[model samples]
Target: MAHIGPAYGSLAANQAKISAKRDPALDQEVQTWIETIIGEKFPNGSYEDALKDGVILCKLMNKLQPNSIPKYATSGGSFKLRENIALFQTAARAYGLEDAELFQSVDLFEKRNIPQVTQCLFALGRHAQRHHFNGPILGPKMSEANMREFTEEQLNAAKNALPLLNEGMNKGANQSGQNFGLTRHI
Candidate 1:
């Protein structure tokens, strides 16, 4: 249902916020990441223009996870192009990107919110690194899980030590009713 109470007043402000987030350096970095992952350079266009048709992105998904997008349009009508974008989006979701991390298809297809498009790419790159995509690293390496198993005796000893720790912590320190630092004066 179309909402009559949509926040129209803040639309421009939100647009400005998104626009401010655009960084040419990040665009270049993301472009490099995509090109490296897909192992192909754009024919002749800006990063946004190169990815607008979604062919590159679909290829990227397939490269990361074989057959992610079984078939994508190399060139065709608008509907075909949009389908390519949609397939990429679906593959991204299936590949483990949170909804917030994925950009809307229209963002790239219509060239709106190119910053978000770049943001989505960076997120994907980071996630791919986390998932160990077996390609050149994209973003920072993901930290590995460190799990420590404690014996029952160790757990019991730690539990019994808590009271001793709390006693020392509560010996004489407190801020229950004390004001810290100078209060601001009007």
Candidate 2:
């Protein structure tokens, strides 16, 4: 019988490539925090564990883009919620994500697509940083001038960060036997 070496070599290879482009220390630190959060929050956790824990998800989002969750939370009142909906819709359109894909409903936590949601939020946060968007939602109407201001390094960093974000989500989901999906929604 042929020995199959590492059934998931592709995942390992992708992780290694991403690690090469980023600071290993930072990666380790973030991974460690994610693991700790999972251990504390979901000892026998499932994908739903991470999804349902808004605090944990917000913490991760804050690390990706400071104050993002708080900004979203502070936008109180029905009118503000509607405004945020429009803002996110515009931003999602700019990011080429479907309007339905917006992380609007808490019921989204019930979906099996937490990894996709995590990636979307991560991308939106990166876009917000590049555009100096300070809205409650990570999405803000983008202009060509704003897009032009993003450096190649910044763009590449965002691209590279996706896998890391996915890996963190995978770590949490692992307790529940759910692997992060690789489908690129953005």
Best by TM-score: 1
lDDT of 2 by residue, 1-100 (tens): 1343553678777645643544434323333444453344433544434444344445444544455445443335545444443444454555455655
Cα-based lDDT at residue 150, candidate 2: 83
* Alpha-carbon TM-score of each model against the true structure: 0.78, 0.29
How badly does each model clash, as a count of residue pairs? Answer: 0, 0
Give candidate 1 regions above 4 Å deviation: 1-9, 163-186
Worst 10 residues of 1 by lDDT: 1-10
- Decoy 2 TM-score against native: 0.29
Per-residue lDDT for 8-35 in model 1, tens only?
Answer: 5578688677778889999988888788
